[model samples]
Target: MNKYGRQSGPRYSASTNSAKAPATQQCQKCLEFGHYTYECKAERVYKARPTRTQQLKKPLKRVEVEVPEEFLPKREGLAAKILKDKEAERKKNKDKKKKRSRRRYSTACTHMQAELRYFIAVVVQQWKQQEQQEQQRIFTQLLFRILALSLRLSFSFAFALLLEVVVRIPFSLLLEISVALSLVQKQEQKCEQR
Candidate 1:
C-alpha cells in the first residue's frame, strides 16, 4: 500500500475546480494552503542548515555565467541636433555646387562672347580684304587705260611734230592720218583670232 493508504490517509480526489478547494494542499514545511511545491514561500526561504562532511572536504567550485552587455538609450536632444547638423551640411554642399555651376556658366558665357567677337573680327577682316582687292583691281585697270591713252597721245604728238616741224606738212592732214591709225588699231584688235 502507499504511505498515505486508501482507507487510513487523506483522500485523493479527481476534482480540478479551484473554487471548491485549493490546487495544492498545505505545505509540508509551513502548513500554508494554495500554490505548488516549487512556488511555495517555505521552499524559497533559506535557512541555516548543517553542512555535510563531504561538502566540507571538497574545494569551493566557481560557476561562470555569460551575461550580455546592456545597450544604453540614445539622448533624444543630441540625436535631433546631429540630424539637424547633417541636414544643414547637405544643404550647404548643395548650395555650393549650385554656386560652382553658376560660376562655370558665367565663364562659359564669357568664353562664347569672346569667340563671337573673334569670329566677327575675322569676317570683317575678310570683307575689308575683298574690298581692298576690288579697289586695287579697279585702280590698276584705270591706270592701264590712262597709260594707253598717254602712249597714244604721245605718238600722235610725235607724228604731228615730224610732219609740221621737220617735213613741214599741213596739221589737218596729220590729224586725219592719226585718226585713221587709231581706227585701224581698234579693228585689228577686235578681228584677231583668239
Candidate 2:
C-alpha cells in the first residue's frame, strides 16, 4: 500500500489495450478487406468465383460398358412387342371406360327426361282439374239463375191470372146482364190472355 492509501498494479494493462481490434474497411471496387474504395492504393483484387451456366447443369459420369449379345433376344416376342401389347390393352381399357361413361350419361338423360315428362303431366292434370272445377262452378251458377228465373216467372203469371179471374168474375156477370146480347167474353186483351 502506498502512502496515498491506494493499492495499484499496471494501470495500462496489455489486456485492456488489446480488448478490441481496429475496425477494418472493405473496398467496394475490389471487395477486399482492410481499405475503403477511395483510400485503396493497391491494385484491385478480384475474388475467383467459378463461372456457372444460366440453367442448372450436372456433370454426367459415363463409363464404357461391353455387353455380350444374346441371340435369344431376337425372338418374336421382344421387349418392344410386350410394351406395344401393354399399350393396346391400356387403349382397350380406356374404350371400356368411355363406353361406361356414355351409358351413364344416357341413363341420366333418360331419368331427367322422365322427370320432366312427369312434371308436365302433373301440371297438365292440375290445370285440367282447375278448369273442370271452374266449369262446374259456372254451370251450377247458370242452372241456379235459370231455376230462379223460371220460379219468378211462374209466380208472376199465377198472381196475374188470379187477379184477372177475381176482377173479371163480377165485371163479366154485370156486363152480360147489361148487354144481354153477346156470349161470355174472355179476359183482357191488354194482359195477352189467349
Question: Which candidate ranks first by lDDT, i.e. highest?
Answer: 1
User: What's the TM-score of each model vs. the native?
Assistant: 0.27, 0.27
Candidate 2, residue 17: the lDDT equals 48
lDDT of 1: 0.50
Considering summed lDDT, which 10 consecutive residues are worst modelled in model 2?
Answer: 181-190
lDDT of 1 by residue, 24-133 (tens): 66555555677544345564445565579767888579897765546545556878999999999999999999899767756764664455344334434444465465
**lDDT tens digits, residues 82-161, model 2?**
99999999999999998997677567646644553443344344444654656544433432333232222233432332
Question: lDDT for every model?
Answer: 0.50, 0.47
Off by over 4 Å in 2: 1-77, 131-194
Reference-based TM-score, model 2:
0.27
TM-score of 1: 0.27
RMSD (CA, Å), each prediction:
32.9, 34.7
